[model samples]
Target: MKTVSIRNPGMSWDIAANILVPPGFDEGKRYPAVISNHPIGSCKEQTAGNVYGAALATAGFVVIVPDASFQGGSGGEPRWLEDPEQRVRDYRDVVDYAQSLPFVDPERIGMLGICGGGGYSIKATIIDKRIKALVSITGVNFGRLMREGFSNFDPLGALEGMAAQRTAENGGAKEDINIFVPGSVEEAKAAGIKDIDVLGATDYYRNRCPAEGAGTRMLVSHAAPAVAWDAFAFAETLLTQPLMVVFGDKPGGFGAYRDGMEIYGRAASKDKELVVIEGWSHYDLYDNAVPTGIALDRLVPFFKRHLSDMPAGSATNPAEANH
Candidate 1:
């Protein structure tokens, strides 16, 4: 595993990434590559990205996990802004760089996005034909989630609040609101949060995760762009790449599983599959060993089948694999 940097030609921003080569990597031979994307408000070192990158590298594919522009080591002004269009472009930028590599088989490139990143991947793959295969885990459509409450409590109220936030931003009041990440079990419980994501995220971020840049805080004014963006709006007809959508069958306080299933049904791809890891909550798939293992088990074969026509004996490097 090595840390690398690439400049996004379209955006003109530098993207920092962790590149994991196969144990027997050969610079002269071309091999399939996978771009692993982290969740929104997460860096490359976070749980899902790191785990997926490492797993795919061990499975004999080149994996690169990059921090999105404006977050972590990536270069962008107005830090922490969540622009869905820009996020989609980030995936394309990463693909552009990966295809330039001598060891990467450009036609066999694939992508795996976790959580909000999964949503962005859907939007990107629809327009960009470079990505041959895709995997989205616990995908959340931000536009739908913000327009209709996560649980469908009140749509009008949510829209009105977002409008008010935009108005405040236009008046020169900077909307830098920090979404709280529970630091302890007591704080999580005392917040009266019934959402399983809140509790699971609290534990993961507080103890297990390694990213210092991972947090719940965000720019409230970003609602302007997020409310207008729909991750699957263009996917019904344009998303023709082989896709695999994975999520826990049980909702468990998070509604993203429904969105994942909807994407699977809407995609036009003839080679598509939906895997439901029963009994696991949405956040459980983020980092928990058992659920993540189940996800990788399915993803490995999917990518191997879709990202085909590789040169014979591609994985012959002999160097030890690093996690």
Candidate 2:
């Protein structure tokens, strides 16, 4: 595993990423690659994205996990601001860097987008054909989540609030409104946070996955565009690549599970599969040992089947090879 920085010209920020090469990697031989993307307000070191990269490297693929532009170890101004389109472009830029590596096979590149990163990955795949296979782990549509609060509670109210924030921003008010972070589990519970998304997120962000640059906040002005964006805008038409959607089926995870299934339904790909990891919350899919271990197992075979060719001398079928 090695950490490196790459320049992203237009965004005015350098992307810092962690790369993992398969054991016994050789410059002479090309290998399939996977670009793993982290969630909004998160960095490459986050649990799901980096863990998957490490696991995939163990399974014979080169994996790179990067901090999105303008966040974490990456460069950019207005530090915690979220740009939907720019984030999508970041994926393409990462792909460009990945393909430049001596040991990476340009033709066999794939991506896994975790949480909000999943939305950007979907858009990136739609726009860039270089991404061959796609995986979304507990993916969320941030635009929708921004316009309509998680679980679709009072969507109109959310949008109205965004309008107010936009007005204040236009008047030169700089306010960063943080969401989903409660000082303690008891506070989150007291705030009527029954949904596992917020509850699980609060637990992970506060206790489990702490990073110096990470916070549960976004610039107030980030709302307007996020509300206008859509991760699945063209899924019913343009998303034609092999797709895999994994979600947790436990109590706190149903919303994401249902959303992923909808994406599977809407995707034009005939080769899509939805797998549900039972008995875990949404955040459990992030770093919890047992469930994530199961997820890595499912991902390895799916990626291998799509990203590599059949072994040169191996049998296509037992009977045919014997005969």
lDDT of each: 0.80, 0.79
Clashes of 2: 0
Residue ranges of candidate 1 with Cα displaced over 4 Å: 10-12, 150-175, 310-323
Q: Give the per-residue lDDT of model 2 (tens digit) for 193-306.
A: 787777788788888888876756776655557777888888888999999998888744335666787788999988998888888767888899898998888988999998
Report backbone clashes per prediction: 1, 0
Q: List candidate 2 stretches off by more than 4 Å.
A: 150-172, 251-254, 310-323
Q: List the residue pairs that clash in candidate 1.
A: 24-317
lDDT accuracy of residue 57 in candidate 1? 90
Q: What are the models' TM-scores?
A: 0.89, 0.89
Per-residue lDDT of candidate 1, residues 202-307 (tens digit): 7777766746777555666555577667999867789999999999976844467889889999999998999999889777888889999999999999999888
TM-score of 1: 0.89
